[model samples]
Target chain A: MSDILPPGSVIGILGGGQLGRMLSVAAARLGYLTHIYEPAANPPAGHVADRVTTASYEDADSLRAFAASVDVITYEFENVPTAALDLLEAAKPIRPNRRALAVSQDRIAEKDFLTGLGLTCAPYAAVSDMDSLQAAIAQVGTPAILKTTRLGYDGKGQARLRSADDAGAALADMNGAPAVLEGFISFTHEVSVIAARGLDGAVSCYDPGENVHKDGILHTTTLPANLSLAQRTDAVLLAARILNALDYVGVMGVELFVTPKGLIVNEIAPRVHNSGHWTQNGCAVDQFEQHIRAVAGWPLGDGSRHSDVVMENLIGDDILRVPQIATEKHAALHLYGKHEARPGRKMGHVNRVTPK
Target chain B: MSDILPPGSVIGILGGGQLGRMLSVAAARLGYLTHIYEPAANPPAGHVADRVTTASYEDADSLRAFAASVDVITYEFENVPTAALDLLEAAKPIRPNRRALAVSQDRIAEKDFLTGLGLTCAPYAAVSDMDSLQAAIAQVGTPAILKTTRLGYDGKGQARLRSADDAGAALADMNGAPAVLEGFISFTHEVSVIAARGLDGAVSCYDPGENVHKDGILHTTTLPANLSLAQRTDAVLLAARILNALDYVGVMGVELFVTPKGLIVNEIAPRVHNSGHWTQNGCAVDQFEQHIRAVAGWPLGDGSRHSDVVMENLIGDDILRVPQIATEKHAALHLYGKHEARPGRKMGHVNRVTPK
Candidate 1:
């Protein structure tokens, strides 16, 4: 790729979800143009982007056209098909690389990559067949999870293996697709470190945020996540180490479990994550903007927080309460332009800032 | 008019300037779509809006189509042609109403309306001919200004009369258009109150900002304008009174001259003003979002300030210094995506915030 793309260069976004919407806003704020390529008609990101191309991701013709129009391509979700990535890579530079995407696309590869970096992870083994499932269960013991290694988000594509007997049916239900069996850890809390790595190899991480999930979806995130200064420093260093090892050139979110021993790696998302939304109201620059800067080859902003912040997601019909939230003196409300209030769908988020 | 327009409802914007661009961002934040209609092909607001229609205000067919595509219409600049407004008003609601626009579109009418409400203004008289100009000059005396009554802004279409003998040439230069001759007020400082009036009759104002102008364009605005407690209260009260009188349903900027006697009304913009740019970083709800809320029939946001702020305009080549300005811990940089940085053009703004 060229040394650095200018500010006016167009950045192509793959998925038109809320993350894409915010990324477009951030990109525009930095004097960069965004062109959204999403298969779905009327994707939310199209509202603020410079242009929108509505076509199926697997349509090679459309993908090529979209790729030709942009200087670099990035995606909001990790589940993009490898074939789609191949087509885009042939046309323009793709950041975070296809290798990072492949490593993060499945649970097994992700865990192995982290473990290879001398990072702690929950004990896990891959299961390809029923016999292998039983062997994996024997190795990791019962009371583990059997999760499909691909196309899973929130709580989908996973089942709990209460006992060894349930492993056979779980594997059968998987239909012989690759899966991972992992032992559950008793984590005190869940936290995530959102960090960005520039093309020039500079990395910076925001303060870790303690996250709470309801039904496998993030409910809220509170910053200064009650960690010791040592723990916080360790979490940031771990995230930076992962970004460097991967040669990542954009924002990466690393989810960690605070166990009795220390922080254990849970998963890594190669895009802006929901846990860092508080930065929109509390910090000088937000995660989305930081990601744009990193991808656009600009200098990273000081990701320092001006205040303590709490971000609460407005899921489904929870958006109707925005009026009450808007009345707060320190609250900043952001609502996505989703027409349907479908259950479990993220509708918006609100950030409340308190002076440090 | 409907109490609430749905998410996909198109909002027609009258003038495609920087205020319109910021308003489009705010509208997109609320999930309402924006359609920009401007005579200029490459309007600033068009860069980010969903659609752009380039046609003259006199083109009824284009105006009809633009009005028909959107549920409601609003303006960025106050000097919208009355005929175009009539066409738009025939189709949908024109917010802040044409009456406020009419009052503000003319300098003499604005002063008369404010003074009719028992408010103080510099002495002024209408001049339609050379005789009237001489008589008005005799009354207001020298060192006053002779300004065309219509379609004037940012120190344009106005000439300073240094002596009584220059009144005839000034009036002749007006080219038979209606004009206003106003007595000059020696002021210690110039300040403005950015206030919003909700559809439900709620009025809220940010703290008045002391302004400094250079070369007929605003250079900087500093909040907490060295005003005493009584003066601040009076400024807020004046803004509220103007909103109530106009029955305004959006953000209106009231500029005042801080004279020896008291605060005198200078002019009013029936739309968001440049003076409120500080709110984008200093207040909980910025003027753009406040204007959006007022027009959408939503409850007004808390306009409380979190910090003392100074906002500097980045005109023309000043935008090239964004990188240097971005390094400041307290400065938030905002750039308008205008493709060309012409001389004296408002390219962007930066706000420096400090704790009150």
Candidate 2:
């Protein structure tokens, strides 16, 4: 096994959102210094990190300096450009590796990779133009989603095809960028398994949580998801199998569609995920610390739950409910230091832990 | 309730130790800024806080500027001189109030306050000199301890009178300082309840943990302490009563001696205590964050444990065990970023959490 980075070693982090902010806090708790690299002024992560590099991701000189200043590198978001990853990889080790990022950055690549791993996914086809779109429609039918192959998040860059009449306008709106058409799968519920794989190949997973989404954004996650014990085991095993297959390091979130028959892979997040936020107040080890330990080449913490937990996302104006929420006997509130609670933005979350 | 301080308000902390360090991190997590006002250069708390004020306690101008810069003042250690507190209190509010500090700062006053509250304590008497020492010996008897009335911590400024013959030398060594002589009480075990009280009079207490001491410093604390249900309830009630009595507005640690008859109050800490460190990895709301909420006049969080935990102090070279400890399946390791690990110094702690 590789020698784990010692406490006090600097870990370079990409992106300065709330995820990065939480990661910095976790790293600080473990006696590690964090250097955040992000372009935004007054980034949320900058408030707690030991040092910060405020520069554009395309700035090679600044990125190079950032890479040289840390023992290892990790990122909070997967949409980081491949060029930036290449530059960081040349200077220092980048965890979760470029392969994981390569697979997850595009919808087509992610579906193909999962299917290649012998995992089930919704039917999908790449569409480069109207010809491909027509072909994909012929194969996949209407009522499918046409999404850009890259640079899409939070319901952006996607359109729904309800019938043959909707296909042309969807293809025309693509503006010539590469895209993919995926047939929608009717599933009973949505769930996610957040698991971590250590450098030593050890894997541990928290219990799967049933998720509810509104407007393509996560709204809530309730633990002890409505899966039979056997199905829960299968879900966790599938997550572990994917981690081992990718030779992945750090925590990964596997979003799955739980159908009547079985589970189908939806997407993979190579970093600490929003759905795993419940672990902060429900389990022995949180996803942020688990990710840090894995990237630092340390052993994975136990992912056992001691309470049945429910996590509610506070989007936009919902943050104003913090005062009332704080009065609850079982609620633990966490708010990100964002200046404005813009609509659809994740401002904070409150975890309610009940005795098992 | 008074208006809750906004996120950008600065909190002035009077000590720059591990407790201060953790408090600063907690404050930042809640979006409030912290300015550590410590006399020592390069204090541990300075590593993570937004700002640090390095000036002696006697520097009135610096003290005034620091007070003016912060919205409110709190302290990590209870031994701050009354003069320093007086200077700061004139400018900003100090949580927990000066009355609690006055009562806790001196051993004689603490014992008197506890006894005055109709709380059980070991037999004790004040000793002002040789004459008073002899008189106190006659009243409290032999096999007692003579401790200086003020400025003592971690077993400093105290002498044991194991036999009647040791009394004269113990008195001489005290150097004419006001002192307290306490008759030893045989106890089954030692435990502490870490609890918090908010401005609204809300109180929350973590389960009392059995503590083991080595060389006068806490070595370990195991949760679900080997105490009967009644004993646990009584311990928590004692802590809450103390908070109510002091009108405390932050986290407080109440140390108790578990005698065969019942539990007896040992001492009280007016701020976050070391024994509560397990909350960082085991409970939903840690003592540091609880303290922040209280001092900010915000509602308190639930102090619920999600896991059975054991927290072991990493004193000096013990920090070298981080790698081995990190390898454990469920160990959450935390290290203070101290540049040097001198003997008897607390460098960090590792918490092992197991499902209940």
Candidate 3:
């Protein structure tokens, strides 16, 4: 193939979750075949992928063979083991590169990187022990949250400290791992910018989506987020800056806390985010297709929103409401082919679009 | 699974062409796994399907296994062999039913069925020999088309009869098989209704899309087709009538020739039609998904159009223009993972939506 991977080229994806399932479908839309690598048998993406290698990331032989079978590599999750990345990167190009992954993998590193770019985030300090925890509590104040520095998601590995007395209990929740103490910021709502940068360095950002989380999990993401024109511009620009700084090639989700002062950077995900699911119905080109186009060295498609959309995640028992949702007008239901609907597990999502 | 085939249920699809490829993707969106049965190795649908059985329709063991592995059976094409259908129907429920398939498989039968329902169709006569050919020419005048009663698609197995003198040549073109002679209707344009019927006998129809054909292949399908309010209502009602008459349980494409007399039935496809491809961008529930929902015993989704869309097929060498189309705003491309683009082959299509 030339600079652009032609149709029929294999796109290898790591982690065959719902995001990967949608990505594989998007890859197929662009005439590219996707090979999914996941340890779980009958992973959701495996249902749509051209091939699936059911082997752990530590399986070097499988990893090597997987790398040899595709043109480029991309991923659904950011917590891939470093050694697996080292092996895959040696064989094929990996989009959103390792540095992007490293920064997002650790809380302190991510906050430091965002602050280094002059972006505003919550006041935070690293804590490795009780002495450091006491110092962090004093510096960041009593109403703060203690979070593990790495491998944390969906509010897991986190504890709230109502006061200095709760610091001891919150710090104990971290076990022996290092953590970050983040002072609580009074925010009205949360919004995220789903942005992308192509291999050619062209950047594109979708309209910001307002997010609502329940039980520390995303509940719904609505388009036309409640934001002033200036706030919207700021969200897109800051997201673009992060992508440019990392030389990222793929879609990235940058969550922000909209406070009274301005938008505060919450965290960044180096892959397509759940908050961006509304684009599947609101935009001409969805995030999954946009990421595939970027990593495949093709031109980025238009990401302009055409309709107002409310994307509600069908977590666990929310799938039971599908029959009711199916009868509703303008509701597009997308369900992952997971056998069990365990509590807190994402079963599916519905994108409800308003008619023009 | 109750009345509905729950998530992770297998759906077996026969014929692995572009239609099957899209249907497979739609099935995945609804958390249903698809197994493709095709005689050819490396069929397009196989790239995204959960499994593929590369055996001929006549292979009884393969067909048995394919049927045994799925809750329901459906097809992308109408001309599946009789013996294959008999074996498959014995093992699993086939959507649209065998009667719908039988009527659509033969041109004369389709016309007769349409006329039997008090629907208007072009004057037609069946021809099996020279005497019958002459009789058909007398019944259906000059400027007619002689087409094989069975196994005709994409303008294949057809010949144009300009006058009475061309009858012998047109009959010879049938190769001693059965044929139908249709009197030409002077029409302003061709339009189609993509309608669906659920297992519960409920029917839904998308807005009429006007179609333009080139070289006997569908060239483009534009939404909000040129039709009066009354005509649009009539088009949908007639399509629903046909589906109900056949006791159909899936999406059907009804082609109508807009004539001075009224809408004349050009043809009807038992499955998703190329004319309905615009639904992919214009509507919330596309034809593929509607068909999947109907076959899976799920409620049919809303088929309301949300945007104006013009869908153009990328035939053969037209695939080269993808790079250019990829950069266009509001153009949604869907390509079949076919390796080669031979002349007259439909490699993919681009649905261009007008900004809302």
lDDT of each: 0.87, 0.88, 0.94
TM-score of chain B of each: 0.97, 0.98, 0.99
List runs of model 1 lying over 4 Å from the truth. Answer: A1-4
TM-score for each candidate, following the candidate numbering: 0.96, 0.94, 0.99
Ranking by TM-score: 3, 1, 2
lDDT of 2: 0.88
lDDT of 3 by residue, A80-146 (tens): 9999999999999999799999999999999999999999999999999999999998899979999
The C-alpha stretches of model 2 lying farther than 4 A from their native spots are B167-178, B228-234, B305-307
The DockQ leader among the candidates is 3
lDDT of 2 by residue, B308-340 (tens): 899999999998787778667667777787878
Candidate 2 residue A69 Cα shift, in angstroms, is 2.1
DockQ category of candidate 1: acceptable
Task: State the weakest 10-residue window (summed lDDT) of model 3 chain B.
Answer: B1-10
Full ranking by lDDT: 3, 2, 1
Off by over 4 Å in 3: none
Give the Cα error of residue B215 in candidate 1, in Å.
Answer: 1.1
Q: Per-prediction count of colliding residue pairs?
A: 0, 0, 0
The DockQ values of the predictions, listed in order, are: 0.48, 0.54, 0.75
**Candidate 2 docking: what grade?**
medium
Q: Per-residue lDDT of B1-356 in model 1, one digit per residue for the tens?
A: 24656666888888888888889888888778899999987776775788889999999999999999998899998877888899889999999888899999988889989998989988898999988888898899889999999997778878889998787778877888999999998889899999999888989999899999988899999987978888899999998999999899999998899977899998899999999999987766789989988888777887888778899999998987877776577777777777788888898998887677
